[model samples]
Target chain A: MATHLILRKILDTGFVSEPPPAADPALRTREQDLQEEILKVFGQALTVRHVDAGSCNGCELEIHALQGAHYNIEGIGVKFAASPRHADVLLVTGPVSRNLEVALKRTYEATPEPKWVVAVGECGCNGGLFGESYASCGRVANVIPVDVEVPGCPPTPVALLQGILAAVSR
Target chain B: MRIGDNEWPLEQRPGCTPVWRGRVPAERLPALAHDVRGCGGQLTALWGSDDRHLGGGFAIHVAFGIPQGTAWVSSDLGAEAPAYPDLSAVFPQADRMQRAAFDLLGIVASGAVDARRWLRHGAWPEDAWPLRRDFDAATRFEPTLDAYPFIQVEGDGVHEIPVGPIHAGTIEPGHFRFSVIGDRILKLEERLGYTHKGIEKRFEGMTAEEGARLAGRVSGDSHVAFAWACCMALESAAGSPPPARAQWLRALFLERERVANHLGDLGYLGNDVAFGIGFMQFWRLKEEWLRLNARLFGHRYLFDRVVPGGVACDLPAGAQAALTDQCDVVAMHVRQLKEIYDEHAGIQDRFVATGIVKPELAARLGLTGLAGRASGQAVDARVDAPCPPYDQVKVAIVTHDHGDVAARAEVRFGEVFESLRLIQELVRRMPAGPLLAELPTAAAGAEGLGRVEGWRGEVLVALRMGADGRLERVHAHDPSWQNWPVMEPGVLGNIVPDFPLINKSFNLSYSGQDL
Candidate 1:
C-alpha cells in the first residue's frame, strides 16, 4: 500500500492538493503566509522544465537527485516536463551562452504566461568562472527576466524545492 | 607508422625528424595521410605546443578519422608560420577544425578560405597565441563580448525561433537558431562558446598528472574518457605504462560511465516523445546508478578517480562483487522496461522514422559513435583501434542501417549488454598490482598522442612537453565536435516536435565541444 501510494505520488501531475504538515512556530509569518498561498494555488503539485543557457551539469546532478529514491521529490508533487509549454515553472541553470541566447528567448516565449523562471546556480546568477569568455553572454538576467535565483555551485535539492514553492506563492 | 599488424613507428609522421630521443623515422608522412583519406576520414583535432628539452621545437599534433587508427600528423612549425594543405576540400568536416587550428595555435592554413575566429575573441592580443611556447598562464586578460556577427535567416515564410544558451533544465548552454517555415525547420544555425572556462589555457605549466584531472573536468559527463585519454598520452610521452590490472579497472569505470549515461538518455528521449512515465522511471534508475558510482567510487559523476600513471582510487574488496549484483538488477529491470517500451505501439510510431539519417549522408558528413554506428557507420574506437585491456578483449561493433531514433536507442541497448559483459570479465580476472605508478619526470621536449574509446565514441588527447617538463598545450577533442555538425543535416526534414528526439539521438555534449 505504501509502495502504491509512493508510485501514485511519483506519477502525479500538477493537479491535486497534498495535505500540509504542521507548521513550525519558529518560522516567520511571511514564510508561513507564503507557504499557505503556494499550497492554495499550486496545491503541492508542479511540473518543472530545466533550461541550460550554459552549465557544467553540476547543478543538474542535484536536480536529478531530487527525483531519486532518497529525496523522492515526486512524493511532494514536483515533476519534470519536456516542453516549456507544459511546465509550471522554468528551472534555469548555468551562465547564458551567446549561442543559446535566442533559443532561450524562444523557449520563454513558447511558455505560457503566469509562468515563472528560477535561476539555480552561481553561474546562473552570475557567470562564475566562464564570465570572461568571448562567446559568453553573462548571467541568466542578461538574456531573460529571472523570477528567483537559487545560488550554489549547484543548490541543494531542498533549496531547489524551497525556490519552487516560493515561485508558486508569487 | 603502420609497421605491421596494429603497431606503428611512433613519431614518424611527415615533414621532420622525431623530437623524442627514440630514433623514430620521419619518412612515413605521405602514405599515412593517404591511408586516412582513403577511408573518407575526418580530421578530429589539430593542436600544438612548444618544448625545449627534447630539442626545443614547436610540435603540431593532428588526429585523423574514427579510431581504428587515425594518422597522427605532426610537424615542427619553425619560426615561419606552420602551414598544412587544406583537407576541407576533401572532407568538409575539416573546415571548423582547420579554423580552430589557426585560431588557437596560430598555424596558418595555406588553402583555407573561411578563417573566422572560433573560440577566440578580444581576450588575448591579436598576435598573442595562447597555445604557444612563450605564452604565460598567470597573465589575465579582460575580453569584450560586443558585436558578435550572428547570421540572419531571411525569408517571407521563414520565422526565427531562438532557443537558449540558457533555458529550463540543468544542462549545458548552447544557442540554436531554427529558421522555420510553419512547423518545418528550414535552417538551423548554432552559436556556441558560452562556457569557455579557459580549460586549455589553464593546463599550462601543470604536471601531466595534475593536467589529467583538469581534462576530465573539461566535460563532466565524459570524465573517465577525457582523463584516460590524457593519462594515455602523458604516459606514452613519459614512457610510463600502466599495469595490466589498472587497464582493466579503467575500462570497467569507462563502461559503467557509458551505461549510466545511455540509461539517462533513453529516459529523456521518452520524455521528449510525451511518455512522462518512462522519463520518471528511467531517471529514478539513473539516479540510483549515479549513487552506485558514488558508493563504489568517490564521486557521483566518477570525477577525480582517473589520474595520470594509473587510476587514483582502487575498488574495495566487496565493491566489485556489489557491482556484479547491481549489474544483474539493472539488466533485469532494463529488460522489463524494454518489454513495456516494445509493447507500446505509440512509441514505435514516434521513434521509427523520426529524423532518418541516410547512410550515404552520414558518410558524407563523417558521423560517428552511436549516431554514425546507427546509420551503418560501423566505427567503434574500442573495437577498431584496440588499446590496452580492450586490445586483448574481443569487441563486436554494433551497427544499424536505419539511422533513426529507434536504431540509436537499440545501439545503446546493445552497448549496455556489452558493457556488463566487459565489467564481469574485468572483476573476475582482476589483477594484483599497485593501482598507480609514480609519474616519471617528462623531459623538456616530448610529444605523444593517446586515444581512448570513451562512452560517447573516440576521445583523443595529444600532449606536448614545455621547457622543464611542464605541459605546453594539450588539445582534447570529444566525439561531439564531429557529430554536432551532423545534427543540422539529421534534423533537416524532421518536424519541429521531433527535433528534441533527433537531438537526443545524437546527444552531443555542448560543454565538451565549447571547451
Candidate 2:
C-alpha cells in the first residue's frame, strides 16, 4: 500500500522539471581556454559546498529551492558535497561576519586547487543591507577571491543555478 | 503578584493586541519576572538597551506571554552602576538574552550563573558596546582569536565530539560540543553567536520606515512575521492601525509564509532519513508554492511586502481563486505523504522516540513554537492572545505530548492543514478597504510594541522613537532564541548518527538567534 501510494503520487506529479535556464556567458570570470581546460576536468559532474558566512538564511533557502524537483539541479550532475575537500565550487551567501571570517577563509583554503567561489545574494555581492560594520566583514570578496556575485536580496533558484554555471562559464 | 490573577499593574499600549507596556524600578525587575512566570507567563523576549544619552542609565526590557496578552516590561538602571537583578534564577532562558544584551549594550544582569559571552565571538573588544550611543557603527578593530570554554564531563568511557561553526550543509553556522561514550550521547552543549552581524546596532537612528526593511531581513525565513511585527510597533507608536483590508492581507501573507517554511521543513526532514521520495515530492510542492508567492507578491519570500502601517502589495483581481486552488493541491499532496509516512516502519523507526524532549523538561527550559507545541506546551500566541484577524480566525492549536521526531512531524502536518484553512478563510472574508495606511509622525521618546504569531513562533518587535522621529532602540526577537536552547536538552541520550535527524526535527534558526 505504501509503495502503491508512493508510485501514485510520483505519477500525479510527473515531469515537473522543466528545461533549465541559461547562464550568461558574459558573467564568466575565468579565462576561456583555462575555463575550458578546467571544464574538461570537472565536466558536468560539479560539486558544490555552500558556506553561509553570515546570511539571514534567505539566500540559503533559494539554494535549497534549486535542489527541488522543478529545478532538479542534482539531475544535471551537480551534487552538494558534505566537505570542502570534495567540492569544486564554493557557493557562499551573506556578508562575511567577523565571527566566521577565519572559518570561511579556512574553508576556501581547504578546497583543492582549481576551485571557483560564487558569492551569492546582495550581502555576498556587496554586503546587502548590512554593509561594513563593527562585526561584518562586508562582501565575500572582502575576505576571499569571488568568481561570480549573484545580486538579489536572494536571487531565485533559477538565478542561483545560473550563478553556479557562470562560475564555470567561458 | 500573579499576572493571571491580575495582581501586577500593566497599562495597555496603543495598537493591536492586549500588549501592555510600562516601566518599573530596577529593584522590581526580578520580582516582575518571577510573578509573570509564576502565572503561566513565559518570557517571550529579553534585551537591554543603552539609555545614557537620555540621561538615564541602561534599561532592560522583558516581554512575557501571560494569559491575557503579551506584557512588555522595562526597568531603568542608573548609569554610574548599571545592574539589574539577574533573571536566570526565575527564568533560565534569560541567561543568553542577558548575555547578548551585555555583549551589545554593556548592561549587566548582576549575579547570573552563566556570565560567559553569548553573541560576541571575538568579533569586537569587550568594552566597545556596539549598541551604545557613542559607539560608531563603522568602528573596526583587529580581530582576536576566541577561546570559548566548553564545559567538560569527565568519567570513564566519556569522550568529546566537536561539530561546527560551519556544518556540512546549506545551514547557518553554530558550534555543537557533544560528550558521549561511543554513540549514546551524555550531554550536548551548543555554542551559537557565529552569525551575529550587529543587527541591533545597525537599526540605530533609522527612520521607522527604514527599520521595517532591516527587521524583515533579521531572519529571512520569518520575513513577513518580523516585518509585520516591526511595522506593528511603528504603527502602534504613531497611533495608526492599518485598514481592515491590509490586516486581512497581512494574515493571508503570514499563513502563506508558514506553509512555505513547513513545506521545506517537511521535505528536509524526510531527506535527513534518506527518504528520497519525501524530499522529491514535498520540495516539488514547495517550489510550486513559492512560484505562487512570486506571482502574487513580486518576491518569492515576500520580502518588504509588509511595510509600516500596512502591507506593500495587494492581491490582484481573481488572485483568490488561484490561492484556493494552490491550497487544495498542497493539502491533497501532504495528506498522501502523511499516509505513506505513517506506515513506513523504517522511517517510523528513525523518527519515533528519537530526540525526546519531555513535557516537564520543555516547560522548564522554555521550549517554544512548533517544537514547543510538539512537546505538549500548547501555547500558541495566536490562540493565547489574538490581535485583529487572529481574533476572527480563531487559530486551532495543534500539539503532541511525545516531544520526539514523530511528534514534531505530526505537529507540522497538523499546522499545514490549519494554515491552509486560515489562508482560505482570510481571503474569503477579507474586508474591502485601502491596502496601506499612512503612519502619523511619531513624537520623540514615544514607544510601541508589535507581536505576531510567526510560523516558527511569536515574532515580537519593540521600538522606541528617537529625536526627529527616528527609531532609537529596535529589538526584533525570533522564537529561535528560546527554542535553540531546548534543542540541546532534546539531543541528550540520542546517538551520534541520529543527531542530524533529531536536529532537523527541531530545525531551530541559527542566524535568527545569533542576531
Please report the candidate that would top TM-score against the real structure.
2
lDDT tens digits, residue span B1-515, model 1: 44323344454321111121122122343344455556556666665555433454555556775333656666655545666566566566666776666666677656776777766545555566756656664455554453446567787987888876554455566668888889998877776665555567667778776788768856767888898888888877787777777787898889888888888888877777787767766766676687787788866777768787788788886987888888887887677667666667777889898888889988877787888899998888787667767767777788899999999988887888788788877777778888887778777767666777777788888777877768876888888877887888778766787887888778888778767
Measured on C-alpha atoms, candidate 1 has an lDDT of 0.70
Model 2 alpha-carbon drift over 4 Å, by segment: A28-33, B1-6
- Cα lDDT of model 2 by residue, B1-515, tens digit: 23743466668876887788777887887878777777877888999888888887888999988888888888888786588889888888888999998888888889888989889878798888898888999999988779888999999999999999899988999999999999999999999999889888888889877899999999999999999999888998899999988899888888999999998998998999989889888888888888888998898899998888888888987899999988998899899899989977788999999999999989998888899999999998789888789988889999999999999999999999999999988888989889898888999988888889898988999999998889899999999989888888788888999999998888888888888
Q: In model 2, what is the error at residue B466, expressed in angstroms?
A: 1.0
Docking quality (DockQ) for each candidate:
0.25, 0.89
CAPRI grade, predicted model 1 = acceptable
Name the top DockQ candidate. 2
Question: By lDDT, who's the top model here?
Answer: 2
| DockQ, 0 to 1 scale, candidate 2 | 0.89
True contacts kept of each: 0.38, 0.94
Model 1 spans > 4 angstroms off? A1-54, A65-170, B2-34, B39-41, B48-60, B66-68, B78-82, B121-129, B132-156
Residue-level lDDT tens digits of model 2 in A1-170: 78888888888778988788787655554443477788887777899999999999999899988888888898888899989999999999999999999999999999998999999999998898888999899999999988888888889888888888888765
